[model samples]
Target: MTTIVFLHAHPDDESTQTSGAMARASAEGDRVVVVYATNGDHGDAPEDLADGETVVHRRRVEAEASAQATGTQQIVWLGYADSGMSGWDQNDAEDALHGADVDVVAKQLAAVLDEEDADVLVGYDWHGNYGHPDHVKVHHVAHRAAELAARRPRLLESTMNRTRMAADRQARLDRGEKVDWDPSAPMDDGNPLGSTEEEISWEVDVSPYLEQRRAAVRAHESQGDTAWMRSMPDEEFATMFGAEYYIEPGRTEPIEKGWPFRPPD
Candidate 1:
């Protein structure tokens, strides 16, 4: 079976970003593995976190549930602490993922790639999609690890269709609807969120795995209702997340209509 490894920034990131694709891969009898770059020790604390319960521990538990629900064959952790947002002091923490040496982290991740013999390695887009510090680091680490590994796999970078996001927002605004977050707002590196549609290579239709995706998302209970995601109505959730997008390595060929597996040959 073909093996694909998805490298993500945090615990819940897998469910929100790559679970649909991972589930589809596993369903097709391919082995799916998820590698998280950090333990998410610095995320927002769930209101119900038991007294003295560490955020790291809580997120790990949630990630495990997410992995199982997503049909992931294995999950690996990089064991780094969360590097909060761009300006947070946590970014300076000794163990913060953002502060870690890229070479050291890349070497560690390369070991996993070598161990799994992955056929494909999925990473974040250049700006980490939304410019989160840890997310950006995952992008660097993933690509660097692939380079470090003697045997390289096809590397794909996960990204949002910023073109679609803007279009959807404008359509909503025209309909007298109010959107929550502003995509054009200054993100982590002062770049716009996601990439333009023309830059996107894969617009994966994950609709068939919607149920699995939902279950995987729900598994991050600590981030579920407490986070902004679970508050969405079922239909809205499906509509917004039914597709995943990616920028294929070395190929700027415009995206055509197709699912995840049909990457540019």
Candidate 2:
């Protein structure tokens, strides 16, 4: 069985982005681990937070639940403080994820990859899909970790298919159907969200694992009100989220409807 490591910037990120792939991999008998870069302390505070729970505490609990629902074998926390956004006050905090030294964080993650003897390492896109500061840091640390890994594992950046999203949205609008997400809209870093189809190197179909994905999403109870994907109709959700895209550095083109991990024979 292959061991796959997924390094993400926060807790819920795994659910919204890579949970399907993680669930599918685990079900195929491969080992799957999710390493969160931060505790997600900056998310929306739930109004009904139990007596004395902190955002970090609640998020950690939720993340663990999501991991379990997704069939992830293990979840590791780097324990860095959350970096709110590009200009938030949290960005200046000494322990914020954005302030962590990329090399230091990479070394730590490299240790995990080495210990797990990971065959594949999943990370965020170079621009972190929309250029969130912490996510951009994840991209940086992931590359450095790859360099430090004892046996450098294969690298895949979780990303979205911008081309497909644009087409689907336009088609839906033409048919008088409303689209929930708009890729063309301005993002946090003033960049186009996600990678174009040509930039993606693989598309893993996780339709069969949508249930796992759904459970993972629901596990983040605090984010219940903002979980846009879960708000979509079942058919729409299946169509839009059935395929998860990835970009392998230096790959020229995508493998049509391919599986990202191929076990060693």
Candidate 3:
């Protein structure tokens, strides 16, 4: 069985970006693990949260629910604090992971990969799925960890195809919907970071896991625009964004067809 590890920056990152793929892989009997770089303590606070303790506890529950919805067997926390987004004053805060040693973070990830004996390691593109500092840190550490693993797993980075992403954004705009399409919005690029569509080595057909994906997304009510997602018809949402795209490392040639997760003959 292929052991896959998905390294994410926060609680909802997995669900919003790659839960479909994670669910589909788990359904196929792969041992899939979700590793969150932070506890997401800064994500949200209950209107009645009396103290920091309550907020932390609530976030953990939310993460657990989200993990369960994605069919993840285990959730590993790197025990770091959220670094927030770029240019934010907190990005430079002493307690933030952004200020932590790169080697230290990479070592923590390497330990996880070793313990799991992962055959596949996945993370966000350099843009960090929106240029969130924690997201970028996770991507960096995941790659470094994969490189240091005794038995290096295949590394896959998630990304959006330029043409398809643009079309999708336009579709939303044409509907008179408020869309976040600013080019300079940290990581909202019209194209894949450092790659083209032809360079994408894997496209997981996640149609079967769409509901699970939605459920995972809903589990993170504190983060995503759940109401906006709920407003859309299931079929329409799934049809427009059903599959997760990836760029596989060490693959000399681009994937012409077929799932890349299948074992070699």
Q: Write the per-residue lDDT of candidate 3 for residues 1-265, one digit (tens) a residue.
A: 8889899887777876788888888888898899888877677665755555665577777778977887789988888888776777877877688777878888888888899888888887776756677877777887898888877878888765654666666878899999765432334333333345676777667888888888887776765345566456898779645877887766768654456554322
Specify the poorest-scoring 10-residue window by lDDT in model 1: 256-265
User: Would you give me the overall lDDT of model 1?
Assistant: 0.85
Candidate lDDT (C-alpha), each: 0.85, 0.89, 0.74
Best by lDDT: 2
In candidate 2 the C-alpha lDDT for residue 152 amounts to: 89
Which portions of model 1 miss their true places by more than 4 Å?
224-226, 259-265
TM-score of 2: 0.95
TM-score per candidate, chains pooled: 0.94, 0.95, 0.86
The number of the candidate with the highest TM-score is 2
Model 3 regions more than 4 Å off: 48-53, 171-196, 224-227, 250-257, 262-265
lDDT of 1 by residue, 1-265 (tens): 7889899998888888888898889888999889999998777678888988888888888888887887898989889998988999999999999999999999999999899887788999998998899999999998899899867878889998888888888899999998887777777789989888988888888888988888888878776433566667878888878999988778868896565552224
Which residue ranges in model 2 land beyond 4 Å of their true spot? 178-181, 263-265
Clashing residue pairs in all predictions, respectively, total 0, 0, 0
TM-score of predicted structure 3? 0.86
Candidate 2 lDDT, 104-213, residue by residue in tens = 99999999999999999999998899889999999999999999999888988999888988998899899998768799776788888998888889999999998888
